[model samples]
Target: MLFARRADWKATKPDNLHEPVTSTKGVKVHYTGTRFEPFLEVHALCAMRVKEIQREHMEGKGDSEIDYNLLVCRHGVVFEGRGWREQNAANGNRELNRAHHAVCAPTGSGGYTDVPEKMVRGIQDAIAYLRRHGAGWEIAGHRDGYATQCPGDLLYGHVLNGSLDPGVLWDGGNHIVRGGETLGRISVRYNVPSDYIILANPDDLDASGKVKDGMKLWIPARGVPLKGADPTPGDDATEFQPFPGAKWFHEEPSSPIITAMGERLVAEGCSEYAKGPGPQWSEADRASYAKWQRKLGYAGAKADGWPGETSWEQLRVPYVGQKPGDFEEFPGDAWFHDQPKSRIITAMGKRLVEEGCGHYSKGPGPQWTEADRHSYAVWQRKLGFNGSKADGWPGEYSWDRLQVPEDDD
Candidate 1:
């Protein structure tokens, strides 16, 4: 939480070129985007880099000062940019700039994609500093409302999961219930255990365990190191079934995975199936999942029955030998028909054989052929697809459902 003044970086005096902004919605995190060299961890080098960025902003974009409100270096030092006195120009457009204060990390692709713990703490400190200076409670990545991936994948993951939040004290506190806020949502926001919160606030809950608006509830802090109970214990490393894309559901795919997911939904009291929660995707599965989303406080387009990453993670569907993020992304429809020869095809062919749909009499070779097509058609049929939908060419949805291992795997 060390602060360096604009004078510390030898920054130019305020030109009043940037507009005045006393308050903002929250803070948006950004990264260097380009490669950030490792040698720049030195304090002098970090200051030099900040000065370089300021010069780039002044000369290239014709800005009055650095576009960011604050800049955090890898060594956990917070450098003053535009600071709290002025609106930042880094959040894409004028409207966005007015809404959020921008905070840049000196981490990016190539050179420093994985941020260190100290750097994470530095960014957390930056957010805390912003909140103290009239910024609101929201915290988002730069790519949230914009087009480009300014914060990159690693940091954006932290932003989504609340890892970058300057968490409240874990000792204990009274929290006034906000409108539309549930115990589940509150636990996520505070990084506390829901069970612990419920145990602490028995007086505030209704007969069915729902909290009313404006109810004052006790929030027990995590990491108390008590003898008998640990509020947040280490999670067992269990494998989770990766979400086979939404298209897989509409195609009526039949697999053990489907039955597992249905069983989980049933356990959660969200089952809508009239008969068997069987090894097949049906309209019932969609309806049941919609109920699950509703229970989670989602509505409108968000509760459309299709699985999103956030909802899927919350489902905690037991793994069938694959982790959530380990699956390969779709390589595009053109990759299959381009006469390509690669191990990815071989892996896919092997999976098809394993699924008992291999139509080839010879080898499941790396190249695409009629046998491969016929074999894939069998797979499509196995998944309950038909006619034009079972055309044998790999669609992104079916490909994802197939869970074809990457060449590296």
Candidate 2:
């Protein structure tokens, strides 16, 4: 029988495809315990393996066709097997037969091994195809859904950690930046606060506060924080005290705002020469003025590792025109107080959507579009918010956004 080359394998459904199964719960990935003698011959071997599976199902096991829904070879070829609509008998458990689709990876050995780039891509494509077809599935290793270690340790590790899956692949996490990566773009891509990225790698600090490609700073695994420590000044205290000389912006004094604002100044191309109010400015009226200057991008604002006057002017206050409690109805003042939650801005609106802070409904009121969800998910992951099912919703994890420090440098 003629076998199709792995390279030519497309994700098309078979002409005799069955109706798609409904309510897919998860995916089961396997590793074929086979090795290719020569790397170049791997694709052919993979094609042959597909034929073997079909033969086994058709004759030996007395089944209709291949038991697996898809197969990926070391060469990165993807082959449609039983077809997702058809019930697969690959796993011994009957419950999984109705809710899971089986995908197999060609393992060089029975144990841990490096999956070829091609094969990894093929697996990602297969998963993407399945998800697009309304499969309510999360990628899983065979060990997750079955009583077997069929996909092996290496593959299993990626699945458990939520890495090397369709989401990361299709969403641009696969690309490696050499040096030209700007913190703004990276912040938008990963939905992380740009300031946090700079804080993580002060050495990457450019005069403009953005990281350039080939800068060699570590992109913390998505959802991992920079220092992996509290960004807030006083973790032990509930109420925040004003830094000496720094005027309190609010009567209660919000620590999160202080840290988030400081980080934002650093990201918006602030210079390091700027001076933070320090403990002195903590209670000074000029502190808010300093923050306003940093936000406005005043000249000389450098993330140069120092908060100075140039940074202060950039964040210069936007002319509130009225005192805090004046009943004259200052729209600007209200806008300032109701600035859509500073945490929301720092975290990015999209990130808020991912955290499920707002509903993803068809209309508005905190609902997000597909692009919004996708972008925010990426950003949330970059900020080390990994494993947070909330994605961008304001929850306990998002509270961490408030904990960022003001003067860590």
Candidate 3:
């Protein structure tokens, strides 16, 4: 592999260097996030770019040195930055920097979607070198913990799919499952059969034939797709996933369901994820869910980030199961709180009155009123909801049950 020392690139010696990072969870893959020039393929230009990056990090970003431990060029040449000796600043914040070593590639968005094979090889080389030093086994993209799209989509996909891993050979070795992966998903990942994996590690799975995060399973060599057919995500990637039960959310380990939920939260403009809404549950998920709850008129402890049945139903994540019927999407609790004059509200009031839940003394006009809450509360009680769940707020489940006429308003 072609390699260059800092001296080779004439990089200015940085005045500040942090204590050496002797250990880390793994390496984070990054991209230049700038337009790439064809001329950069030349080693000299690559060197110049490396210098430019150092200058930018040191002068522009006020970093003590180049943020990456190493950088890979288009031609698969690895250039030393901090060179695995010092901590990197490119992983977003202090905690993230402490956890993962950073390696950047000279690639970016817009006309730079496809990554070169050689570039990938160089990144793998950097990762391998880091591992031999003190890095752990996980390989992740910068976006895994950071909010920005540094590595971009194509490369980030490679990181998640293990294309960036130095090893792809499945030798029936012991495999450790991480958050967001199951036996079925792992089997598809390694081209191994589900039954074969189950047969090999009989003690690792639970009664339901599922693997938990951090569980170790021995995978037999690649076998015919489960039952001599191709494998698909099945319910794993559905339009509307059934709530995996409250326990799954409250206590289950990292899961793709959580990731799906995070994505939904983001879609609903209620994201609080700083790093990832990845498969693992974190404060970000709770904070984001709290936003969703508050949007739905929940307050105080009611707006807590935990996913309740009503809130989860309202989020309507596209995961494993679908909600039946074509009721109008919940316009959000905030909308009703705004007391907007609209035909939608009028129609909803009519439905509440028809259901014998209306407490209105006057017309259930376009304008919202306290009577709407009283009526909705009655409906919620009729549905067996009490306490906070019975609050007059129009939850998605109750709203759907009411089947208020669809209105342009």
Candidate 4:
């Protein structure tokens, strides 16, 4: 493989940097987010782009050094972006970044999609390099980490389908994505988070958060256990708080997640239960969740309504509304407090329609009208969360019943 070390690129000194990453789940696929010219010569243009990313991280973003451990140029050449001895800034948040080494795509990885074959190969080379070292087999995209769209779509599509995987990741397993699937949805299938799916199959999603249908992805056999409820998040809590994922299913019971799942199932016209879609993954909830699963071409065990990450995501259940985790840290703030008009409100409106909760003769939109609030209030009351929780604000408990992606809002 054609490899260019950092020395080959003549990189500049960085202002600051943290300790070298000690261990990690694996590599993360990233794009420059800027459109660079593709080149046949490989070294020159790709090297310049690598240096440019370093400058952006250090000079523009005011970081210690280049955030990535390595980069792949258009001609399938692996150029060292941060070589080693630096923690990546692009992975997830602080603690999360420690679990990953960053790999960036050269010129063709961003903006205008359709990552070149050569660039894809270069990314593979970078992963292979990381693998040769101590990097784990997991490979996730930027969107899988935080809420940004850095890698772009085309390349992310390749990741979903497996053009970026090759022999790098362990055969943890493969998941063939069905229709209406996202990384979040796919993760739900395996009872894991979208981030786990990304790390297990880094090539599957682009930074913009677009996923490909019928894409066969890698599922990590093991990793971080899903987080349960947090008592105090930002204050004196010693435990770092991560947003709930399929962990909602495996870990301790999250009433909000359970409620959100039930609400979303009802909206999707999958509820068979005469009564409760209550919290705590019940038999009724499974039956309803399974109904929606069958609609996705899942059958038998696949459609058994246990709420896998893929189906949960496909269900578009908003897991944030009534969960213990506060929305103050995420988007859709006013959403949990007031039924204000916003993207999250719009999503809630749509979820309400799916649950047959729409009062409007027309439909829901971005603006939250009295009708929307009332409709949500009605759903809340039906779910047994009456009183202030059912004031139509769709608190953590109510939002969990809806199961909508926090960022999806």
**Backbone clash total, candidate 1:** 1
In the range 218-304, model 3's lDDT, one tens digit per residue, is 776431112221111111121244555566667745765676677667656687877546777888898999999999999999998
RMSD of each: 23.9, 26.0, 21.7, 23.2
Per-model CA lDDT versus the true structure? 0.73, 0.47, 0.72, 0.61
lDDT of 1 by residue, 1-409 (tens): 4567788667866556668888999999999787664434434346656776786677657877888999988766678899877898899999999999999997878766887776786687678778777888899999989998889999888899897787763555788888878888887777665655765665565334687688888776543322223211111112345576676667777775676677567656687988746776788988999999999999999998887778887886654332233556667778888967887787888889999999888868888888888988888777667765587887655666677776545
Error of model 1, residue 164, in angstroms: 1.1
> How many clashes (backbone N, Cα, C below 3 Å) per candidate?
1, 71, 7, 46
> What is the TM-score of candidate 4?
0.39
The local lDDT score (0 to 100) that residue 357 gets in candidate 3 is 86
lDDT string for model 2 (1-409, tens) is: 0113223332223334444575586677787654423321323234434554565456557665667877776654456676556666676666776677777776746323677655665676566655655455577777764677667787777677765465541222223455576667776675443444555555656436754455554444322223442222121111211122223343434343343334333333332324431212143323344444545554343322233434433442111111222112212223323334333233344334454543344322223245444444454454445543325333222233323222222
* lDDT of prediction 3: 0.72
lDDT of 2 at 114: 78
What local lDDT does model 4 show for residue 21? 63
Higher-TM-score candidate of 1 and 3: 1
Model 1 residue 233 lDDT score:
11
Quality of model 2 by C-alpha lDDT: 0.47
In terms of lDDT, the best-performing candidate is 1
Give the candidates in order of TM-score, highest first. Answer: 1, 3, 4, 2
Determine which window of 10 residues in candidate 2 has minimal summed lDDT. 233-242
* Per-residue error (Å), model 1, residue 303: 70
Q: What is the Cα-based lDDT of residue 161 in candidate 1?
A: 89
